[model samples]
Target: MSKIQPLNPERIAQMAAGEVIDSLGAALRELLENALDAQATRIQVEIWPSRWQVRVADNGQGIPASELEQVARRHTTSKLDGCSLGFRGEALHSLARLGSLTIQTRHADDAHGWLATYDRQGELAHQQPAATALGTVVTVADLFADWPLRRCSLPQTRPLLTLVQNAALAHPWVSWQVRQEGQLLLSLWPGQSLQDLLLQVLPQVDLSDLRYQRIQEGDSDWEVVLGLPDRLHRPRPDWIRVAVNGRFVQMPEWQRLIQSVFQHTLPRHRYPLVVVHLRLPPEQVDWNRHPAKSELYLQDPEIRQEQLRQHLHALLQSGSEQASRRSLHLIRASEAKSVYRVTSSPKSPDPAPSGQPSTPLPPLKALAQLYRTYILAEHPQGLWLVEQHLAHERVRYEYIQRHWQPVELQMPVMLEGLSSQAVEQLEQLGLEPEPFGPNTYLMRRLPLALWSEDPEEVQGSLRELSRCADLEAAQVAVACRGALRNGIPLTLEQMQQLLEAWQRTANPHTCPHGRPVYLALAEKDLARYFRRRWGICDRPISDPKLGSWWELEPLGDRFAAQVRRSSSASAPDPKDETRSAPL
Candidate 1:
């Protein structure tokens, strides 16, 4: 290669754009941000044939007639108010360099609008009078054509739709609409409240069921509303929004913080619908750190604490009618103790085919207990050995999973010295203890599948539930606790019941935690290990001490013992090749 030479201005300009625009989605985001920054209240977006063409029109402040073409200049902006969504100047500069750009705008004072079009070099190609309202429309066509490599990474329709949805949710007060190939795809109106707008977005949830709350601290405020569990079948994550001063962003940390609130209420793979808006002074929020202006950092401790407080409150409300202060007082997630309220079927799954005998494994005949822990059972084909504790656990877990339902206590038990909120939170775990006397409550019901469990086992189950993150774990934990305790001798009736229940369960081989419940040893396999199954020796090694080569025969223990005693006192007969054979 020749010595490195300086690149020309044209090459340098294109190189600078490579860092600014990477995909069609990136270009679209820039266009959308610019529209919002212009104070657009009604925005319409149109896309054609995937990433082929895109146009965004906003009814907001428009550029002056004289300075329409100058907008392509680098680092140029009219947003000096500091309250604008973003001030990064690379968006338009990079976009114009990637493909053809057209801007049609008219100021309110202007009699008519002017249209300016440009090629990838940021040079104006056409300028003429164009009919338009008091707003701006920016259209980018031939996306990433100049940079063929970046164009290859173009995303499908889903990603672009997600970007548009985020923009719409960011400005709930703004009327938003979308069109694809002259066909209408989405329409949203600026309604009375955010919930109204969300209702239009997600018709699956009933708007009235969502809980709403507003909290303020100093100059900052947070508005949040969420749907009830019954109505929480949310759509794509694009529907869940977190905006900072009317600007939606990609903040994983904020999303995770919100997810923590609904940990016990929803599965890990699923999420509930929530709409939250954080309004604060522009100076208090920092958006300059990320290239997308998508990440925001909150520097105000008061606002941070308020977020934690409200998050806890919402979690409690959704979790149970009773909110426990003990769990909510801890603001930091590191210190927050995990507590779960059980939400499940109100009754057991169903009685095991009423009065039908459970399928029995007759091969396993119960024999005796070993170490007071394992049950030894005999079988002609094999030996059956089981750990009663684990077996019982598997039996109960499977039974409960099938026959799960709410449970009623045979008699009430009383306990004292717990607060009402505490009791309520506990009841969420399916323990129905109610107030009976001062600082006391009478426990009346338990989780349906585990109602007949020992009180200690029930308490243990609840304690285990506190460590679990979801409902399945809670159910498994309860089952494990209610099962037979290890080292406890079981009566004949109890063991029989356990076996019968285990047989009724769908999965009886392993406990809920995935540990094997029992082991089987085949008699033939055992005989092989004992060296007693060889009918006759095809070959034998000579033993000088006994002066004999061995042969096997179907002889009892007494004959083998006599042969061994005689071999110790006698030498092999030299002339007899059959001397080693046992009769």
Candidate 2:
């Protein structure tokens, strides 16, 4: 017998079915594509999880009654020209092999509809006249019943719902609904604009900062809608959706291109929510790259990529500059508010009477500013060097934490261009913006930190804060932006005030951004570096007796003598004066 032989018909059928209709999601996708290709205006999907069955009905030009028997036959289709989503002609045939397949349809030319059933071999087994509207209904029962393993591995309802939603997004003009066991899972009406459809699908995303653009080239038209870089970002790139020629497909090169445009704008390991649709002439794209028709090859990919990159860069660049200006205006407003605030003068510390306990951090006297960045101070236990910027950040962060109360505004501010979901999120974060009009809110109060901010800037900041992953991250961003910058001169009184404020913070060791606020050099470490005989040096270095312990012989003279001795000797010692303990 030959080692390799042709497979039997039953085994071949099993393998082919496994490839095309592998999961419930795959089967649903095929049905949806068929409905869309038929120019469906309304589609409904019903599922029975207990029986692993699905039914898809569509209002479109359906199959002809006379050709109903040939619908499920292998290698039979009307979309051989590659313009339609399903050109392989194997979807119905493979589905029939996996389970019981029944299709009921009525063509415009036919007087009535016909229902046909197919067996596991994909051959028509029964045909009968049926009363139905001018459309098609495909039902698959007991899917993968013959293959128990595959049946158990089928996907759950979520993937099926996702498939339907993707189809709806790609064809927003069509109405769609999905139900499971008589319970509605999703419903989308027709005549929804693209922006409205996106907002409906992605309720969690804040579309207040959304940007849209359309471009037309020689034979291709592109529509790009996306969220600008803000506090909103996802840990994964799954939010990026792309559709080509009315078909939702995976184009990784384009996804990466979009990411590259926002690489510098967004933080590391974060991605923006972007939706792109490209409509090109059929001849410019090859849709036969993948078996399921999820991937495609586009002509002149490099040129298209460059064009998209330029467009995104231009838009985002202008957006970033505007954001910066808003931030600057807010900061200046805050500074103005601080100037008029009443603050008590710093009082000198009184000596502890009868030896009472002191605070957690010992009172330090500010000596000088080192390099105009770090503050040098004298502490009881050691010499302290504090990063000016980090210390100020911690101070501001804690102040905001303790004083983050909402104050009633004298005049109610009208915040426009906010989504309903955005308003809800703002309320959850303690803004309590009431709905005033369509995509507008009436804000009667504002957070204490944002009180002095302009109404427009406050609106922008609130939108950013609402979209952030959490409260702490938003606080960090605000504190970081408003903190004192490094390399700026500070007076002795200003330095002292900053140090006093920092000392009162609950977490003074590290800044809100997790950077070390100060470095402490203890007396013992300093003594050890000077090669002192005893661990502690209580006397001053100017004292003649303590001079030997404070000063060390020049290292260059010792190194030179060692090198001369080594040259005169037969061999140098492995370890010499060159190796010394770290200072």
Candidate 3:
């Protein structure tokens, strides 16, 4: 006897059916795709978790009565043009082999509908005449019946819900409803725009913060909708959705690319909510690579990747620039409300004198320092509360990045407790450290921003930088260390200078570590809080006499001087030394 023998047709069919209809989710996907291919504008899905059954009904161009018998036969499909989502007629056949299959369909030309049933081997069992609408309805019961383990392992609700959501995202124009045991689980009506769909799906994000853009280059066109830089984000990348040729897919490389575009603006380990749709010529797309059709291969992938990167960068940069211009105007308007006299020199370069045109800064007028941590400033539209430390950090980070050359110290600073890995990373970041004593390193050169930092603090920052895996992260660590400490009081002139430096940085909205630099309370909001209409005060009050209720007392000049000296001599409170977490 021959050692090898060809498998019988029955066994071969069974294996192929197992591959196509492996789980409840896969079976539902195939049925849903078939409905879409039939040009369905409305689809309804019903699931019975207790019995492992699924039913899908659609208002589409249904199967003709003449071809109804052959619908369950393998390789028998009317869509030979390869334009439909399901071109191979194996879906119904595989479905029949896995469980009981029934299809009732009526074409537009037919006066009546026909109902057909098929057995496990896909053999036609019964046929009857039925009155029905102009569409198709398919039901599959006892899915994976023969494979007890697979049937028991299948999820009942979440998988089905996710599948429906993915389909709905790609086809917002199609009305859909998914029910479980006759209880409605999910529903989407027709006539919804793409932005509306996104907002409905992701309720956590604000609609105004979302941005939409469309780009067409060469043989491909793309539609992108995403949150503004760091405005909305999630802990993981699960919220990023991508669709190719109207089919939602799992494209890991594409998701990573999108994340990389916003890496600088978003905090570490955070991802923005984004939706991307790419439309390419059918010839350039290969959907046959996966049985589930969840992955695709595109021609000229390198060219497409490069184009996407450039366009996304431009879009985000443009949005940032517009926001900056608006902020500048608002700041100038606010500055017009008050006037101040400069008393002390600014640590950074001074802004241009009153009338000369220079780099635009949101000329906010500093009113007072609040709690020794926040700077209260006046803006035309509202009140701005700036986190003094983070504002300075943003300024220092940008400054260090722009001027990164190292300067040799007259006397080398010795750092201890640095690991070998940390020492190597420090050197790569332009801080040349040489081994001195046991577990100690001598830093001969430092970045200009860190040249004046105290030796002990520099050592601490260098130790922190040594643990960073990348040069950019190390630089951020260094910048955070050199920034002004919290709880340190600032003079009026110093606060003004700090705000100018902050507004001049490339990204003033967030610190290098991605913390917001300031919070704005618009005047209009304040009016609402007081139950007054904008630009109109509902209640009028006469000016009160202060001396009638309270008498003014002045402190002795010697006592005031002593209090100032004590404050200047005090060290930073340990409770206020909160630092930004590492990237």
Q: Between 1 and 3, whose lDDT is larger?
A: 3
Residue pairs with backbone atoms closer than 3 Å in model 2 (clashes): none
* lDDT value, residue 220 of candidate 1: 74
TM-score, every prediction: 0.51, 0.55, 0.57
- Tens digit per residue, CA lDDT, model 1, 513-536: 666566666565556544366465
Compose the digit string of candidate 2's lDDT tens values, residues 1-583. 7598889977876777788888887888999999999989999999997888999999999999888878898879988776788887789999999889999999999998999999887889999999999999999999888779876654688878878877777778999889999999889887444556676777765445667677887787877778777645679998788888888888888898988778867756789878878888888888778777789888999988887777677656545324433344444444453212222421112223422223356666688998999999877776778899989987777666666788998987887788767777777778788878788888888778866556676766676766655667666666766688998999987888888777766666667766657766665555544436544534324447655432554444456567779888857564531221111
Model 3 residue runs over 4 Å out of place are 191-193, 318-583
After the best TM-score superposition of candidate 1, give how far the Cα of residue 435 lies from its true spot, in angstroms: 69
- Top lDDT model: 3
Clashes of each: 11, 0, 2
Query: On a 0 to 1 TM-score scale, where does candidate 3 land against the true structure?
Result: 0.57
- Each candidate: what lDDT? 0.68, 0.76, 0.77
Candidate 1, which segments miss by more than 4 Å at Cα? 1-12, 233-240, 267-269, 301-306, 309-312, 315-583
User: How would the candidate models be sorted by lDDT, starting from the highest?
Assistant: 3, 2, 1
Per-residue CA lDDT of candidate 3, range 1-583, in tens?
7788899999998888888778888889999988888889999999997888999999999988888778899888877775667877788999998888999989998999989999876778899999999999999998878878786564669878888887777777889899999999887876455666777666665655677777887778887778786466789887788888778898888888998888868756688878888889888889888878889898988888787787777767654423432344455554444232222321223223442223333457788999999999876777888999989987777667666678888888888888878788887776878889898989888766566647777667667777887767766777787788999999988998887767666556557766657776668655544436535433333336644211332544445577889998996775654222211
